[model samples]
Target: MFKKVLIANRGEIALRVHRACKEMGISTVAIHSTADSNAMHVRMADESVCIGPPPAAQSYLSVPNIIAACEITGAEAIHPGYGFLSENANFVQIVQDHGIAFIGPTAEHIRLMGDKITAKDTMRKLGVPCVPGSDGAVPTLDEARKVAAEIGYPVIVKATAGGGGRGMKLARTEADIEAAFQTARAEAKAAFGNDEVYLEKYLDAPRHIEIQVFGDGRGKAVHLGERDCSLQRRHQKVLEEAPSPVIDAKTRARIGEICADAVARIDYAGAGTIEFLYEKGEFYFIEMNTRLQVEHPVTEAIYDVDLVQEQIRVAAGLPMSFTQRDLVPSGHAIECRINAESLPDFRPSPGRINTYYAPGGLGVRMDSAIYGGYAIPPYYDSLIGKLIVHARNRELALARLRRALSELVVDGVATTTPLFHALLDEPDIQAGRYDIHWLEGFLAREES
Candidate 1:
C-alpha cells in the first residue's frame, strides 16, 4: 500500500479522500490554492502545499504545481476526487510518466471514454445498446439534416465532447433542425473547442440511470447496482438514490452484469460509471465517466464499501477485497447535493458561514468542509456539502431525509435546502415516478 497519497482537488470531496486515507493508515498531502489556505482538508492533512492563486486554471488545474507537490511531499499516488483533472487523460499520462500513481483508470481508457462519439462506438462494439442516429460526426449542416431525417423528428443534436447540458440542442420537428444544428455546432466549438457534433433519437421522459462498476485492471470487475439520478436541473444531477425504485431485481442484475463484463473486458482499473437513458424498458448508453462520480456515496451506503479506499488498494497492485458474489446490497440510500445558491434564481451565495450545524443520527451522514466563519469563495462550484441518508427501504429513506434536512442549518448564506424540502412533498418524487426532465418542468411550474 502507498504510504502517502496527494489529493488534487478541493471542497468536500478533498475532505472525503483525506478521511479515507486516514482510515487506511495512509498519510495524505493536501494541495490547495491561495483561496483555500484555511480549507478543512488542508487543516487535517499531514502535509500541505499551496499550488497557486484562487483561479482554478492557476491552481487546482495546474499540472506542474500538483506534480511538484507530490515530489516535495514524497507522495506515492494522487487521488483526484471527481472534478478538476480527474478525467483529464493528458494529466493522467503526465502523472504516470512522472512515476507517480494515479488512483483511477488508465490514460488509454480515459481518452477512449472521454469523447462522446468514440465512447458510443466502443460501447456498441461491446454489445451495449445505444441510441440510434449518426454513425459518426456530422461535419456539415447538410449531413446533420440527413441524419435527422433518417432518425426521424424529435432528434437531439449533441456536441461530440459535450457535458452538463452545454453544446446540446433538441429539434422536436423538422423545422427546428437548422437552428439546433447550427447552435449545437457553435456551442460545441465555443465550449469544447470542437465543432464536431453527433445526432441521437431523442427519448422523451427517460430516466437517468447509471451503473457503478469497479475493476482491478486484471480482467476482474464487479457491479454494485444502480443509482436513479433522474432528478436533474439543466442536465445536472440534483439528487440521487440507490437501488432505483423503478428497477426490479431482474432488470438491475441484467444491466449490472452487462456493465461489469464490459469494463472487465477492457481491463479497466479503479472506479467508473456507465450512464444510460432508460425508457420503455430499454437502456441506451449515454456516456462513461472515467473517474469516481459525485454521487458515489449513495452506492457506498447501499453496498457498505469505501470506494476511495478501494481505488487506493487497486492502484497499489492489491487484489480487490471482494468479488461480485460478495457484493450484497442492502436497503436504500439517497444523497442531496447541498449548494450555496439562492432559491428561484439559483444564484451563487458565497460568503462567511456564520453558524453551521449538521444533522446526525444512525442513518444520516453529512459530508462537508465548511465550518462557522469559513468564507466560501466564488471562484469555484456552488456545491458546499452532500447530505446522505440510508434506511431499510426507499420510503423510510425519504422520511429520514426529511427529518435530517430539518435539523441541518447553515446561516449567513442561502442554500438549496428548501428545494429538497419542496421535492419531498411531491407525489412523483415520493413514489419515484419522475424522469430526467421532471425537475426542470416542476421548477418551471413553480415559477409560473
Candidate 2:
C-alpha cells in the first residue's frame, strides 16, 4: 500500500480518487489551480498545492508542476483522475522515470491505444471486431478515396489521435469526401497536434456500448459489464447507464470475454473501457479509454465494486481481491452529467454557487466538488457533478433518477438540469430506444 498518493487533477474526479485512497488507509495530496483554491477537493485533501493559474494548460495539464507537487509532498504514487494527464503516455513514462508510480496502464499500452488507427488494428488482430477501415492512417486523398470506395459511399474520416469527436467528419457521397478529409485533417492537427486521419464505414444508427475491464498488470483481468452511452451530444456523452438495455445476457457474456481477453493480451493494468458501436446484434470496435471514466460510477453501482480502489491496488502490485466468478451485475444504474451550463443553448455557466443541495437517499449517489460560496472557473470543462441512481431494474432506476433530479438544487447559476428534466419525458429515452444520434436530434427539435 502507498503511504501517500497525489491527485493530479481537479473537480469531482480528484475528490473521487482522494476518497478511494483514504479508504485504503493512504493519505492524499491534491494539486489545484489558482481558480480552484477554494474547491472542495482541495479543502478535503490531507495537503493541497497550487500548481499554477486558472488556465488548464498552465496548471492541471502542466506535468512539471504536478511532478513538483508530488516531490514536495513525498507522494509515492499519482492518480490522474480521468482527463488531463490520465492518458498521456509521455507523462506516464516521465513519472516512471522519476520512480513515481502512475496508477494506470503501462506507457506502451497507452501509446498503442491512444492512436485510433493503431488501436483498431490491435483489436482486430486480437479477434475483437473492429469497424472496416484502412489498416493504417490514410496518407493521401487517393488512399482515402480507395478505402471509402471499398467501405461503400457513406464513410467517416476520423483523426488517428482524436477523442470527443473533435477531429471527425462524415461524407455521405463522393462529392463530400475531399472536403470532409481536409477538414478532419485540419481539426486533428489543431486539436491533437497530429494531422493523421483514417477512414471507416460509418454506421448511421448505432448504440454506443462500452465494456469495463480491470487488469492487474500481469496479464490477468476481469470485466464488470457494459454501459449504454448512446445519449450523447456532439460526441460527448451526456447520460450513461449500466447493464445496457439492448445487450442480452449471451451478448454481454461474449463481449465481456472479448474485452477482458484483449486487456490480458496487452498486459494492461488498472481500469479501462473498450467502446463499441452496436447495431443489429453486431459490435464494431471504436476506441479504448485507458483510464478511469466519468461514468464509472454506474458500473460500480451495479457491479458492487470500487474501481478506484481496484486501480490503486493494481498500482501497488496487489493481486485482485475478486475474480471473474465474483463479478455480477445486481441492478440497473444510470448517471446524469450535471454540468454548469444553460439549457437549450447549452452554453457554459461559471459563477458563484449561492446555494447548493444535493439529493440523497437509498441507491442515490452524488459526485461533486462544488458547494455554496464556491466559484466555478470559466476556463475548465463545465462539468460540476454527476447524479447517479441504482435500482433493481431499469424501470425503477429511471423512476428513482427522475425523483432525485427533482430534489436537486443549485442556485445563482444556470445548469443543464432542465435538459435532463426534459429528456425524462421523452418516450424513446424512457423506453431505451434511442441511439447515439437520438439525443442530438432531440436537442435540435427542442431548440427549433
Task: State candidate 2's TM-score.
Answer: 0.99
Superposed Cα deviation of residue 284, candidate 2 (Å): 0.2
Residues 344-410 of candidate 2: C-alpha lDDT, one tens digit per residue: 7888999999999999999999999999989989999999999999999999999999999999999
Query: Per-residue CA lDDT of candidate 1, range 59-93, in tens?
Result: 99999999999999999999999989999999999
* Sliding window of 10 residues with minimal summed lDDT for model 1: 139-148
The residue ranges of model 2 lying beyond 4 angstroms of the native Cα positions read none
What lDDT does the true structure give each of the candidates? 0.96, 0.94
Score candidate 2 by lDDT: 0.94
- Tell me how candidate 1 scores on lDDT: 0.96
For model 1, the stretches where C-alpha displacement exceeds 4 angstroms are none
Tell me how far the alpha carbon of residue 437 in candidate 1 is from the true structure, in angstroms, after superposition: 0.8
